[model samples]
Target: MGMTIALDAMGGDRAPGIVVDGAALALRERPDLRFLLIGDRARIEPLLVRHRRLSAAVELVHTSEAVAADAKPSLALRQGRQSSMRLAIDAVKDGRAAAAVSAGNTGALMAMSKFVLKTLPGIDRPAIAAVVPARRRPVVMLDLGANVDCTAQHLFEFAVMGEAYARAALGVDRPSVGLLNVGTEDIKGHEAVRDAAALIRDSGLGIDYRGFVEGTDIPEGTVDVVVTDGFTGNVALKVAEGAVRLMASSLGDAFRASLRAKLGYLFVSPALRALRQRFDPRLYNGAMFVGLAGIVVKSHGGTDAIGFSHAIGSAVRLVEEGTNDRITAEMRKIASPGPQLVAASS
Candidate 1:
């Protein structure tokens, strides 16, 4: 069957418009794909009606709920039952969709996903996974925010699942893995890091535990997989993304001020375009919440049509590769007890 992406049209900061436009773009580009944009028909029908080219390509699902970006997670999930996030995920859980994508509040989506689809067997919690461009293959970082407070054993489990992600997504043989830490040295991290390192060190799971890595290493594209608790990992991911935008914007403002600089920019404009594409958050939007029973992707909150297209494209690839099914089997394989933690957080 052709892959279908269920998008939460009312989820992002720019609702139906950006979501709908992106779906239209994807539908136009990929002839083998279809999208079910979940939102309010009353609000979206006119938007669709105006675009004859897009009107025929997209289908709308009337979602009566709204989960504002800053709303409390608990309240958002409880009150926003008709939310596009919930409805879109429902499409996946009920087999109406192969995968679902959203740009809603992270915590709220995580909470609702647990409630609607639940986790795979032997998987304690779902970890958000992001694909970061690297020198070789894209590095996949997990636990972006599914579990803020995690145990040492949980971190080890993350490594296992992360490896599965790299294998399924990156096609690496034994995806080199490492734990994000305060320092790259062996004695750098908290108890959880030390414990996870030991567990993976002697693991018979055929994974390459490549020691420790730092925040700077993320942009350097040094590791195939970087594992950390959501609290720490998420901060690093945001900081890195913000840094890219800050530097790019700063450089843009600098080069546009002078005639000499403007002339110089023309010479390097092509290079700059290449670099911008590499750092574009749109290119990074298709992050999966690993350990879940089905595929769920989270896109940037501020994404427009361009970014949304990329996210939907990613959902198609994930579904085609059967990534979630492979991840679930991996979690079941290492369900046994591993090394013990010495009462510490990573």
Candidate 2:
């Protein structure tokens, strides 16, 4: 009776091994959580046998085909009808599972999910949303790589969805929403962002609308939800990742540059490790495909079992919080007439 998550056992780079290990890790944390593992039984069964706790918690549905990492989205859609990824999503659509999680090809997963689950009412396109570390805590960012060119209306809808997700997943009671732009000033952004800001401000969706935010604002925690087109969002996401990697590399170089520095590192090793854990992407592995009729979390394909476990935990949290219902209710409110807005202060 607790939340059930459907997993595509053959979706990730490591496939059944990491999938089974991740499920075991998740099961150890949440005993009541159940899983419907869809993949080749030959590969998965052996792995599951090693974890007795996970063996009892899963219901396997074997599938012979799997979407290839390099396959085009269209190709995947045509040939992946019986694939593990598709079947896992099917479980969510069929009401047999509360959510679906995959570490498969992004395009294939998005295509199959849209085709099977369809979009929610009033949502023209589904956006990929993820939580990123911020100054205070993690901020919810949407349109990570879903639609490259989003209209003003699409950005507005993203704000509504992101705000709801922040409340549900991040436990932020009243999250401030910011439109990602070149500058925070009202006159600085292009027509799309400027227009979206006006819509968010006047429409009164109840979320705290902080007009505009620059790239620096992201890590500064200027707002709780940062909304932008997929192109910009994706680029920003990658740049942030590269920056983290560069810092780590530079730190390593500095430590090895001098004998004194190497000795200094010994004293600071514990603090450095703590800092690394704070910024580890594994802590935020799941990226939710928002605007869908059902919940679907996309994990990083190359992540290890620990990262995959975090992804499963994210799916469970979304289900337990009724995130989809909150999105639907907010969408309905935004669709209705009047200068209506909810009651959170800006």
In TM-score terms, which candidate is top? Answer: 2
| Candidate 2 residue spans exceeding 4 A from truth | 339-346
Model 1 clashing residue pairs (backbone): none
Candidate with the greatest lDDT versus the true structure: 2
Model 2 is weakest, by summed lDDT over 10 consecutive residues, at 337-346
Tell me the whole-model lDDT of each prediction, alpha carbons only: 0.81, 0.91
Candidate 1: segments with Cα more than 4 A from true spot:
50-58, 135-137, 171-173, 336-346
lDDT of 2 by residue, 60-104 (tens): 999889999999999999999999999999999999999999999
Clashes of each: 0, 2
Structural RMSD, model 1 = 4.7
Which residue pairs of candidate 2 clash? Answer: 204-341, 206-342
TM-scores for every predicted model: 0.89, 0.96
Q: What is the model-wide C-alpha lDDT for candidate 2?
A: 0.91
